[model samples]
Target chain A: MIMKQFRFEPLAQASYLIGCPRAKEAVIIDPIDDLGAETYVLEAADLGLTITGVFETHVHADYISCARELAEMNDVPHYLHESATDLVQYSFTPFKDGQVFEVGGVRIKTLHTPGHTPEHTSFLVTDTARTDEPWCVLTGDALFVGDVGRPDLLLGDQALDVMDEATRAETLYRSVKDRLFALPDHVEVYPCHYGGSTCGGVNMSGKAASTIAFEKRFNLAMRKDTPEAFAAFVKETAKPFPDDYARIKSYNLGLISKDAITEAAV
Target chain B: MKPTEVQDAVAKGAVVLDMRPPKPFAKEHVPGAVNFQFNRADLAERAEMSLPQDLTYIVHAEPDPIAKVAIGILSKAGFSVDGYLEGGLKQWKADGLPTEALPLLTVDELKDGLDRYHVVDTRESFEFRFGHVPGSTCLEWTEPWDQMEGLESEKPLALVCGDQVRSAYVASVMQRAKMDAALVFGGMVDWLERGYPVEKSPKKAKAPRI
Candidate 1:
């Protein structure tokens, strides 16, 4: 199995390309607009792998996703959480929780870890050539380096009907503590954002990667003994939404054209 | 058994048991290989139905660990599993042994060629009852040869399940018996995802918990 992390320092966003060398097939996760489709395709070709599938953790409120562009270019399937059926205008293969997609000896299993955004998902990846046990989890924005994703992204946004801040925080807490934390301690953690990214709380570590055990022991968000306390902690660490948060989200949902967002920025 | 030894075993009338799912087996496999997918639950039952005890067997599965587990399962199930092929199918291919393939029909193809095939849903009875391909006949994986024998032999049997794994296993078994069979890639899940119509059982029945 071969894994590559493409980190966009400008947005503090990280995307991954994982593939099975023997099968010569790869899947891109949470591709960002900055890097574009060609970057993934060219890199995969250089590595002797064909881009077989594209996956999105969720509709990003922070930035535009290149999932559609990449998937279309390769004529591969774009996989997203099934809950996004009504929200997303683009074509995708809606994946349910526990759905497994295999690329040669590497198997990717989906875990619906909502709360960061209602349709948020984390991918549990196993390299069957090495072992059946998952070697690492692509946590998306649910579980970060030292903190959790800001559940308050949708707090005051009225463009879409979404969960309130309090409910989202509580749900995010359960998603982290109950679901993500249940992974074996040794499993490596790779998240979409780190410190300096508004998507995560203030305490998020700048370190790109950590382990499940390390985060469980030291993450401030997980230290809370109860969900109520966890919610309170999450709410307190909320950051101000970016000026174009709604538009960026809308762009991701295909609600508005990319040209509209770019023109608005100019 | 090593790839070099596969021919010797075959010459002596030993069957090559391919433990991988039907998809890979259908794509390419040691000619005359029988597929009985390796899994913990019901391995013994499925083996009993799919395999003949009279012949000695050579187990073949990819990734050495799974092949090891398959050998253990076959041994415990009271079958004569001589040994597993070292380095699995990769090594077998590297050794340049001849292989064969079965048809792997996509949902789109199945949709277009519905009239030409006999669709068989290999999912559980309750799952089949809940929703299934309009004309598919439900025959769960564990169903015996007598049940499969009732299938329309005139038309090519197209096997399908939730995902294609179970269907692929069933396809391999049918192919071993010289039946004209094809594995429905992406299975019923793909069919439903494509918004294809399905026929549900008139009476709603609860699926039994495993």
Candidate 2:
């Protein structure tokens, strides 16, 4: 298994490229932009690996996600949770809660982890060739080091008439406490966003990944077992909402095409 | 030379570089001049950071040859040199021109008295996060009403930036706002050059606590 994490310091975003150099196949998770081509793709080509899958851990609120753009350019299967179809206008294969994808010797299972957002999903990865045991979990915004994702960022966006910050917080609490924590402590956990960032502006960890056991012991959010306590922590730790997050969502949904800006014909 | 010309140039946003050692500079010098040793090691590296590339620079140093050399150093590195003070500080003094100085603090003094003063970084949030004074707050640049919130008008502020250029501007803004804020002399360049500890915010430094 060849796993590399790429972090954009300015945006506090992290993307991953997990490859099977043995099978010459790979996949990317939570990509930020087309800059991946210059970085991970070049690295993949050098390793003689073909990318078979791409994923958006969730519809990003800070910067635009390039999952669709990279998928189109590379002609790979892009996947996202089915729940995001109404909020994001991108075409992708939807992986349900319990679906699993096997690429090369790796088994990537989808855990419909929602809380950071309704469509957020996490992947439990196992190197099947080595053993039946799982290796890691890509937690996305559902969980972070030192803190879990801030669920209150959804406030004031009326597009989701059924969802609000409090409701999101409730869902997030359930997702982290019930769904993600259900995994074994030995499983290595990799999540996007890390320290030195705002509550909403999560960055990547220094080590790139931490053990589920370590996070369970060290993360402040994990200590609070009740959903109410977790939601309160999310509210208290929140920063001023990220600037221009709504408009960036429009770009991700393909509603604001670059062609429209250059006045090019559709 | 007319004093008004120097004032006009300064008013138009030229950085005044004083190339005298700290001892001489402290007694008397240009009102907002930043001091860097005239001939010292790492002067080039310091200049690249502490000095702004955009604005013109007016150098004040000793004798004609040395002053020209100082200007040459900056000019070689793509800095805009508007030229040196024709007669230098001694001549300016002889002409009964205005000169002033403030009580200077070494990094040691600032660290010892850290609690007595406030540290404000004028760098953008990203730059500050890369590394900064642990307890300092950020006020990148300010709007008319910006000071009302982020700034503590009561506390003495020591303003710093990537280079002194932005902080120098911020110092003036603080003055107009009636806030007591001084440039951190050489800014981040000097701080890093001195090898003081820099801190990263946990929000951005999100390593697992365990």
Candidate 3:
């Protein structure tokens, strides 16, 4: 499997294109704005590959996502957790938590990692050609380089009532410890954001990727602590909310379609 | 010049004349300094309104080129332009001279004042639409200078913009026009970081309306 990581410097976001050479098939994770999608597609075409799936872990607040547009343009499936169906405005294939699928020889498993948002999911992909153990987990907003997603964004009476600020923080803790950490220490962790992002505070080392063991030891959000302490810590340092959050959320809820977005040059 | 020389001059009753634009002077300038605009055509009239004919004016700008222009203008006007601020206001500040408050709002302060103050964003119309202090009245920076009529000049008008420089200049202009106003100290970024309330202009749908 050949994995290509594209970093959008403005928001410090990372998107990925993972391809299986034997099958000439590929999948993209959390594609950013249309510019990002265009670059990814051009690169894939140059490599003589076809993208079969475009995945979104959650509705992003920092920048607009081009997942819907990329999927529609390429005539490929867009996948997200089933709960995200109501949250996202576009059409997509909804996978239940723990659902498994195979692309070429790679076995891709989806884990419902819901703390960042009600329907957040992370994919653990196993390269059968390399090893039975999963090689790397693509953690979207749920897990970042050093910090977990801020839970307060999902709060308020209108959104998911079950995932209150406190409950979301606790769920995030469990997602990091029980699910992500339960995997082998050697499993590499790839996250969507690094430090300097307004989404979360105090990211780990600002590196694009890390091992499970390294995060367990160094990630302040993942360090062994009481759920209450973790929640309090996150609450105290929660970053100033992004200025574009409400617009992004509404757009994700499908009130706005991809074609509705009018890109402007900054 | 050395710090001691500045101190000695102050001790000898040397006047500290701030030649920066009015907005910055209003935000926080040396307490006793009077404003003198370098670009104003009726500088003699403005000077006659502020300073006595016999006083030796020590002209100072934020830095050199501005100070030179101020000195040249005052000298031409037949006022005794004693000397210039060596490094301008910043250097004077670095030397620990007393400065006064212009009292500009950070984003947090603007948020806190959502219920009380009528914030006025003095940035350009394009920037105002991006984001501004919530409940602020948009007065484009290019708005005619005389349109400031009827508003209570003493009612603590808060001037806000993307940064301090423009607001400072505007404040100085306001002060010269004999109006009372204050500059928002750190500008919009500082205000937003402190979790202040910002109202997006209605024209820009991409930005948030706080």
Q: Which one is best on TM-score?
A: 1
C-alpha RMSD values across all candidates:
17.4, 22.7, 24.9
Candidate 2, lDDT over the whole model: 0.68
Task: List the DockQ of the predictions in order.
Answer: 0.01, 0.01, 0.01
**Model 3, residue A262: displacement in angstroms?**
7.7
What is the per-residue lDDT of model 2 for residues A1-266, given as tens digits with 9 covering 90 to 100?
88888888776677898876445578988888635444555445434455677887887766667787667655678899888778766578887888988887888999987877788899899998688888999988888876777776553558742477778888887887787878888998888876644534232245557888888787777677787887887677666766565556557666677444234322
- Local accuracy by lDDT, each model: 0.82, 0.68, 0.70
Tell me the tens digit of each residue's lDDT in model 1 across A100-159.
Answer: 999988999999998888899999999998898999999999999999998878725554
CAPRI band for model 1: incorrect
Determine the iRMS, in angstroms, of model 1: 14.5
Q: Provide chain B's TM-score, model 3.
A: 0.53
lDDT of 1 by residue, B1-210 (tens): 778888788888888888665556778898878766666566787787666677798888654545666678788888998887887677788998888897889999999999998788888888898998877777787665445545555678999998776787667767766888888887887799899989998643332221
In candidate 3, what are the lDDT values of residues A87-110, reduced to their tens digit?
555678999989987777777899
In candidate 2, what are the lDDT values of residues B1-210, reduced to their tens digit?
234566578778776676653434555777666555454344466577555567787887643444566777788878887877766676677767788754445556666777877777877778878888767776664323234234654558776776554565555544444567666655676678778888877543221111
